[model samples]
Target: MNIKQYLDSTYLKTAQQANLTEMENTKVVQHFIQEAIDEDFKLIMIRPDHVKLANDMILKHKSKVLIGTVIDFPNGNSDLEPKLQQAQTAINDHADELDFVINYEAFKNGEITLIKTEIIACAKLALSNKKNIKFIIEVAALSNHQIIQICALIKNTIIANFKEENFANIFVKSSTGFYTTINNLPNGATLETIILMLENSNPLPVKAAGGVRNIDDALTMIQLGVKRIGTSVAKTIADGHVSNENY
Candidate 1:
């Protein structure tokens, strides 16, 4: 398979954390954007703040690589309003895909209704704008049953509220790649988690994020039916280089 086509070349760093001036940070984003266009990756997954930069560069080069941004990234605890507003801003900046972090904390607290309402609203907003969206359930934070339950809920809710056909436009993404695991547990997508996700959210597609650091692992996820792989090391995997970054 052409692994580049399945890769969502990603770079989601904060300005302070990266220790670069805002302008310099954007230059780094542009570098990844440029690389994606050159390597023909499936899309560029970045922070919401850099949507315009990536969009402008894609337009400038007339590249087919799509622009994707995160919503309530790393943590999915924001209220419905902020999530909607953020989604709107990303759409305005021409993001072709939006990856949302579902509030797993709320779900753990037995607030399934709140979680459902929030996801539906965001999904509708993105769908109405003709943009694809994915829900990052943060598998490392949940049990296998929770993963299955949440995946089914997202798939069912979207089908019931929106056009059932549009279910294909959405994905049940595995991890944010920012959540740390306890006792050194896997922090991102794993074979066991992917199996449960595929069993529960089969038609909805899955994006395996984190823990896929090489070509063999990426191809294994693909062979198991993951539609997308979100990583910061897509080029390394394609070039068959060694990268220590887990994500």
Candidate 2:
């Protein structure tokens, strides 16, 4: 299986999070971007701050690797304005894809309108810019029912407001790869959750982010109908090796 095509080789940690100096952290991002270019992975998912760096490298090499950056990151609780602002910046930096963390917390709090509005506004921005967009639902923080509901919500919202051709550009992604779960539970896409997402999202597409560790995991997700897999261990998986990293 040509697993590299389905992988969004990810590195989203900040300097502080990675316990590295700013320069050191940037070096890591640079190395990842170069590796993605060399390995010909589908995309490189990085923090918003590094989109320009990735874009510059891709341009220099005239590579086909796409650039993806996260908006509102691990926490999707931010107000819509902040998310829009962040996404705009990423687009300005020439990011090919924008993955926005949806306000899942509002959905959990019975704020349906808030969640719907955010989806519509942010999605329109990305689509208008001709950029691919993914809504990270953070499945690890939700129940199975919520997962299905949110997936349907995202699917329905896009279908209702956007053209049919635009549907392919939007995706209902599974997680941010940064959520923390109790009792060491899986903090990302599990088989069960991917099934839920696939069954509900339909033509909207699904991206199985987080917890996908190896070739078998990547293959399983693709077989289950996930169009993309966001993982930090893209190289190991591409090499057919199991990754020991939890994410």
Candidate 3:
């Protein structure tokens, strides 16, 4: 089933997070970009700081792999200006997709206006720049009801503010693959949560990220209608082997 095209091979860890020096971390990013090009994966999801690096490598090889970067990262608590600025920089650096971590805490706090404003503004920035946008809801930290509501909120906001033709460029991604849960629970995409996201965010596509470790998991997400799978083991899955690597 040509799974490589459905994968957004991801690496978003920082130097401190990975216990590596800055130069060492950048080498890892470079290797990931090269691997994505060699494997012809659909895209490479990385931190905003590495967007330029990915861009340069892809250009050098004349590869078709797209570049994707996160906007407010694992925590979506930043104000609107910073998020926009980060997204803008990534776009300027040739990122083809911008995955913004939605302000779910605000939603939990009943701050609907704040969340809605960011969604609209970020979506506008991405679409205006002709880049695809994905809103990561960080499912591990949210209840099922919150998952459904946030997905619907993002879908509804995009639909109301943009033309239907642009819907294909927007997505409700599952996670950042960096959330910590109680008792080490699944911090990324799970079948139950993905089902809720798919059903609630219809017509606006879904990218299943986190906890998708092997070929079986990837196939299940695709069968359930996910348009993309974000993982650190894209090559492993593409080669038809189950990876023990934790995303």
Candidate 4:
């Protein structure tokens, strides 16, 4: 596909949620969201705290927008209950979709059942209000074999959630930027891996995140079959094409 066509497609702008604690940080996020809205980017992924800010910005600018937020975030050690509560709170705050991390330890320990149960519980919590939930499997931490296993767990959990609640809008994500090993997301290989996983399992959508920094990287992933691209670099890419911006 052409670079511009891919650039014009759906990708996500991620504002580190923990940074929302400060006024300046929030303002920067708001500014980026506005720019993305003006450019008509596909989606904007912000921290839970920025939901109201993002929603207000979209309304003020008269732009139609889709909102996404993460649950359990960079680390997967948090108990499932709190993660479930966080997902519930995100939905209440008007997030259109949710992304969350799976319990890595459970999968690493070969406790497949526990992993399935945990994801199902969290997915259930998000769907309790009939919200769309996507699971972040932290692909950066998983070995090739573990990646497939994790995907299997996610597939089963998604099926289970659907059978019980029938609200299965699950997505498999690549990485949470919080972890050092994947502080940067591998573009080509990661996209290929995700495609392989999808081909082997049910056709759930996949989100490619972590180190996406430019238009080329974003386009490459999209061409490779990634339905979503997550990054903090949207402003950088947009700025490269526009003039007279306050830096």
Model 2 lDDT-worst window of ten: 238-247
Stretches of model 3 off by over 4 angstroms after superposition: none
* Selected candidate, larger lDDT, 1 vs 4: 1
Per-prediction TM-score to the true structure, in the order listed: 0.96, 0.98, 0.98, 0.79
Q: Can you write out model 1's per-residue Cα lDDT over 1-247, one digit (the tens) per residue? A: 7989999999998877689998888888999999999999999999998999898889999999999999998899989999999999999999999999999999889998998899889988999999999999999999998998998888787777877688789999999988878788889999999999988986788999988888999999999999999999999999987689978
Provide the lDDT at 170 for model 3. Answer: 96
In model 4, the runs with Cα more than 4 Å from the true position are 1-21, 160-168, 182-189, 235-247
RMSD to truth, every model: 1.2, 0.8, 0.8, 5.1
lDDT of candidate 3?
0.93
76-111 per-residue lDDT for model 2 (tens digits): 888889899999999999999999998888999989
State the displacement of the C-alpha of residue 149, model 3, in Å, after optimal TM-score superposition: 0.9
TM-score of 3: 0.98
- For model 2, the stretches where C-alpha displacement exceeds 4 angstroms are none
Could you tell which candidate, 3 or 4, scores higher by TM-score?
3
TM-score, predicted candidate 1 vs. hidden true structure: 0.96
